[model samples]
Target chain A: MHELSIVFHIIKTIEQVGEENKLEHVNSVTLEVGEVSAVIDEYLGDCWKWAADRSELLKGARLVIEKLPAVTMCETCERTYATVQYGRICPYCGSERTYLLSGREINIKEIEVG
Target chain B: MQNNSIDVICAAAGSGRMEHFMKEVKILEIKKSVFEDNDREADALRGELHEKGIFLLNLMSSPGSGKTTTLLRTIEALKDRLKIAVMEADIDSDVDAHAIAGAGVKAIQLHTGGMCHLDAGMTRQGLEGLEAAEADLVVLENVGNLVCPAEFDTGAVKNAMILSVPEGHDKPLKYPLMFEVCDVVLINKIDVLPYFDFDLEKCREYVRMRNPEAEIIPICAKTGEGIDAWADWILREVAAWKADK
Candidate 1:
């Protein structure tokens, strides 16, 4: 539901970033969305095209989404790995505890403009 | 000689003006987020909330998701143990405050003047003149919505949501963030299960799919069924949070 609105914000930001760099038009935008950031990736992509097509500077801009896996740092081994299954336990060390490192990320990494 | 020189200068000026007007290039570069400026304010609000040891809870749900009822019950249950208060955000109504006050809790209402969602600055302002300054827990009953409220981060310590059984089990699938960002989930309206086709296990399953670690507590506000257990769970969380802070 918020996909279209978020896409609009992303497009607007891209335009500003492009203009700041003196670019004529945005060709592509790279957004790194964490697997656990509560954002629907497929829906985001769908909303991206519809929103980008309306803008003058960002019209037809490609939305490239980089899906990030949920990772946690092990308390015992101090190693980080994808949290494939449920539970905050470390995958390798089998420790009952671990800190969540990076999974909830919604970021605009870079933009390519002409 | 002076008249000839003046005539020549006027002709040159006219030609130059014409050249400047004909087919000049367009700059064609200006794009910016209408709300990018709001993001920084939102971040600052989050930091401020954390620094003050305020465990902020932004409660979101459908209109009839028992938000106010649950809050009234919560305030009644947890008042003595925790320094708690309520901030109600609405388009234009003071009814929520009246209801919260009826339950014997400090209440403040913020009218958005028709804005759909509550922003960080509005939240900070809403907190003013309230008795929650030394509060351990502060709850914000967000504008009754499943969409716009999910987008704005009111610098809350935790975002919680309610999904009444009558609203259906497919809600998590439809409104994922309301379930995803939630640190706790209260599956409200369980008393109507006999009259409706709502499933407790199924509802939990749906939420778990979106967010595995989400704690789900099923309760019926109208009948006071299972409210104590749910309330106990929340109070424990608040106690734990205060200790951590």
Candidate 2:
């Protein structure tokens, strides 16, 4: 699954950060995932638990996720609306000239170490 | 050593877990994109390709969308003018690679070991395996999937996808990211358009709604119709990529 690859990327990034900061152990990691980023949180958590336990520094580390809502901007109306509520078509203007403003983000916000 | 000595003293003084209580936990603010590493790797690979004067095209599409057939046609059209190579990525099997090699070009197969997509690192490895420096154009036939491949950049100079007539025109709306990332959309199997009730204009409109800048080329890889236009697009892209530097 793509979530496994994402977990691998997270581990790799965390390992790089650990080396740079000389971290002995990671306590937790917080992620900022957009609402429509296509990443399933449960699958990500499952993949993280399986993969993190294999890394000595990240063993037993907790995974925290913070969701960012999806927003779309209508070019015709110049108004922003919830992407999930009203998809490609603008609800206000009934126009197809709309683009996503946000909601596809998958970022690592922070990490806790002890 | 100081903390260890304090812990020993605390233990000797019968202070229950004073050292553990005194240990400080710190939060490191690393506001980084999850794809930051991959994106950096992809950019570096692009720079390397540019210096080598090589054009890498990342081709993506669904299974049975005629990627291999279209690639064969493309090679037949451009093989005489340009040195072309291919890296076929799949979860298993070397069938695509074999087909490409049979076409009298350098071809290598990359097995992703069940991964659905190829990242920048995997692409570099494939390029190395193919000894791609000898070739002017190296096409990475990415795993035949629309979703995961769009999320990962394969370090290619350009990205293209094949949407067959049977797949419906709403694919751009369904897989918006795939269409948005592609530089060109090849609408293949146009020979059967009359039988399929596939409206080319409607498809173009949908793709434009997703990506206004994408160039759509309608072709039938089987009949070799409109292949010259596709070949022309490649020729122009390769020339532009080489000339820019």
Candidate 3:
């Protein structure tokens, strides 16, 4: 449901970049989505195909996605661990004084123009 | 450049052949988070709200979690002491907004059209619609969804969530991110403790395991069991917010 809104945001950003670079056509876009971002790539792709086809610059544009691992930092032991594996608790020290360091991102990494 | 070298080699070994082999292609590096714009807007809104001395509390919970009932009860408790307003966000109707207005406080409904969550920009617009500048407290009753609402910040001074006893005590394990970001977690519907097998202590432990700093308050809005404690928490938060200003 929210994927369409996200696609619109992505298209607006690419259009701004295109305008700044004086480009006419966008061939593809590369996105770096975190493992824990809760944004499903399949839905994003479907939404992109529906929305991007309507834009003049993004017609037939390809969408590529890259995944980033989620990591958590333990303040007690000052160690980093996989968030998906152990959640909020630190595996090394059994400490709940931990916070997420990464893996909640939805980034546009690159844009290819032809 | 590599293509140009390949073209040069092709020309050297060619048997009298000419072709158009050069094409202009640009690979622009745009390493930007899709949420960067929203996060920046949230920070700016936070700064603006802080300057205006308005304590914004973002309330989130799952559907049928008695968020409206809790809000009404809260208003009855704190309306005499503080000026409160509500911005109710929903995907479709204004039912919650109407309920809030019936409570005799300023209320505004934000129709997200179809969006599942409320972003900072949407919250700012809602605040403007409610004329929240004059109110001492603005409660943004965010759209009822545990997963999506926790993903976005709406420039609120504090984030609070409600979990009813019927919703099960294992909510923290299922929705860890929500518990992780909340400053306070209100375990509501404790009056039904005898009916359901909801373990209050186990629930508290689950919430604490995810967020050690979060304050868990047990309440039954239907009977006003823990309304005083909840109201006190709000007053303390409002005072601390003012002190920071």
Best by DockQ: 2
- Off-target runs (Cα >4 Å) in candidate 2 are B1-23
Which rank order by lDDT, best down to worst? 2, 3, 1
The sequence of per-residue lDDT tens digits that candidate 3 reaches over residues A28-84 is 988998888878899999999999999999999999999999999999999999999
lDDT (tens digit, per residue) of candidate 2 on B1-245: 12464342211112212233335866666777889889999999999999999999999999999999999999999999999999999999999999999999999999999999999999999999999897889999999998999999889999999999999988998999999999999999999998897889999999998899999999999999989999999999999999999
Clashing pairs in 2: none
TM-score for candidate 1? 0.62
Off by over 4 Å in 3: A71-101, B1-23
- Docking tier of model 3: it is acceptable
CA shift at B87, candidate 3, in angstroms?
A: 0.6
Which scores greater on lDDT, model 2 or model 3? 2
**DockQ rank, highest first?**
2, 3, 1
Clashing pairs in 1: A16-B31
Interface C-alpha RMSD after superposing true interface residues, each candidate, one decimal: 13.2, 9.5, 9.7
Report per-candidate DockQ: 0.06, 0.46, 0.41
